[model samples]
Target: MAIHFFEEDIRSEIQQKRNLKNWIKKVAAGKSFRIGNINYIFCTDEYLLEINKAYLNHDTLTDIITFDQSERFGEIDADIYISAERIRENADILGKTYQEELRRVLIHGILHLCGHRDKSPAEKKSMREEEDKALNLFDSADVPRGTLKK
Candidate 1:
C-alpha cells in the first residue's frame, strides 16, 4: 500500500504528501478498493505528449494519462502521468487556482482506477461528481491546502 510521487521534468512537488496519501487511500477505500504501489510522475506537456503519442497513439496534448497496473482484483496499482504545464494552463482557462485544478487532476486519475469512466457525457458528469466528492473529502478533513512549485 504505497503511493509515490516523482518528477520527470517538472520543477514542482506535491505539498503535504502525507495528507494526500491518506486522502487517496480513503478515496480508494470508499470504492472498496485498496491502494497498491501507485506512482505519479509529474512532467512537462511535451514529455506527456511524447508518451501520449508513443503509447496511446494519440498525437495530442492531455492533462493526464493513467496506466492501470493492478494485478489483484480489489487493489489499485498504476502509473499516472500528469502534465504540470497543461494543468496550469487549464487552471487559468477554468478560472480555478492552480492548487484546485491540480487536486482535481490528481483525483481524476484515481477515480479512473476506481472503475469510473468519462468517455461519454453521462460518464463525464458522473466522473466529475465523484471528483467533487473526493475533493470535498479533502476539504472537510484536517488536511491543509496542497500546492505545487511553479
Candidate 2:
C-alpha cells in the first residue's frame, strides 16, 4: 500500500500525507478491500482540462479524474488527478474550507476504487453515505490497525 503525490503545472502543499494514508487504509479495510498503489497527481485546471480532453474525450474541467487499474476485487491501483484551482473554487462555492473539500475529493476517489459509484440517484446516495462514514472515521481519530480485509 503506497500513496504517491505529484504536482504538475502547480506546485502546492498537501498536508498530512501520513495521516491521510492511514485514514484511507482504514477506510479500505472497513470496506473489505486492500490498498494498492495510489498516485495522486495535483495540477492546475488547464492541465486537468487537457487530461479530460485527451483521456476521457470530454472538454470540461473537473475537480478529479480517477483512472482505476485494479485487476481483482480486493486490490486497488489508481491514478487520481486533481485540479487544485477547481477544488479551491468549489470550496468557495460550497461554503466549506479548502481542506474540507480537498479531503472529500480525495476520499471520493478512494470510495470509487472501493466500488462506490455516484452515477444514479440511489448510487449517489450510497456513495455519499460511505463518504460521510469515511470522513467520520478520520474525524474521530480512533482508526483500527487491522490487516486489510479480503
Candidate 3:
C-alpha cells in the first residue's frame, strides 16, 4: 500500500513523491485496483542494463523495465527499474522536459503492472493513451507542475 523510490548507482530524487503517490492512487482507483507496494529503482543506464540482461535475457538497454509481482486482481507489487541517462536522452529527443519524460516512463511502468502490454503497434498506441490519461490526472491534481522536477 505504498510507493517507494530507491537509487542505485545514482543519487537523484523524485521531487513530487507524495503527489505522484496520490496520482497513482487515483489511477488504480479508476481501474478498480488497489495500490500495493511499488518499488521504483532509479539507476544509471549501465546498472539497469545489467538487470535487463540478467533477468529479461535482453542485451539491449531500455529506459524502464518492470517486473510484475501481483498476486491477485486488486493488488500490485512491482519492481520498476528506470535508467536516468536514457530518460534524459529521451526527454531531449521527445521535446519534453526531463521530469515530463520521467513521469511518462513511471506511468508506463505502472500501466504494465496493471496488465497493459506494448508488444504490438495497437498495444503501443493504447499504452500511450493510458499514459496520457495518467499525465492528465497529474495536471488535474492540486499540485504545482513545477514541483515535479528537482
lDDT: which candidate is best?
1
The lDDT, on a scale of 0 to 1, for candidate 1 is 0.90
Clashing pairs in 3: none
Query: For candidate 2, lDDT tens digit of each residue in 5-39?
Result: 88887864577667778888889888898889999
lDDT (Cα, tens digit) per residue for candidate 3, span 1-150: 799888987865577777888888778777777888999999999998899899989999899999888888888888899998998999999999887998899989888878789999999999999999999988884544445544
Shift of residue 97 alpha carbon in model 3, Å: 0.6
Q: Can you write out model 1's per-residue Cα lDDT over 1-150, one digit (the tens) per residue?
A: 699889986854467677788888989999999999999999999999999999999999999999999999999999999999988999999999887898899999999999999999999999999999999999884555555333
* Order of candidate numbers by lDDT, starting with the best: 1, 2, 3
lDDT of 2: 0.87
The per-residue C-alpha lDDT of model 1 at residue 42 equals 95
Against the reference, the lDDT scores of all candidates come to: 0.90, 0.87, 0.86
Deviation from native of the Cα of residue 78 in model 2, angstroms: 0.8
Query: Stretches of candidate 2 above 4 Å error?
Result: 143-150
- TM-score of each predicted structure versus truth: 0.93, 0.90, 0.92
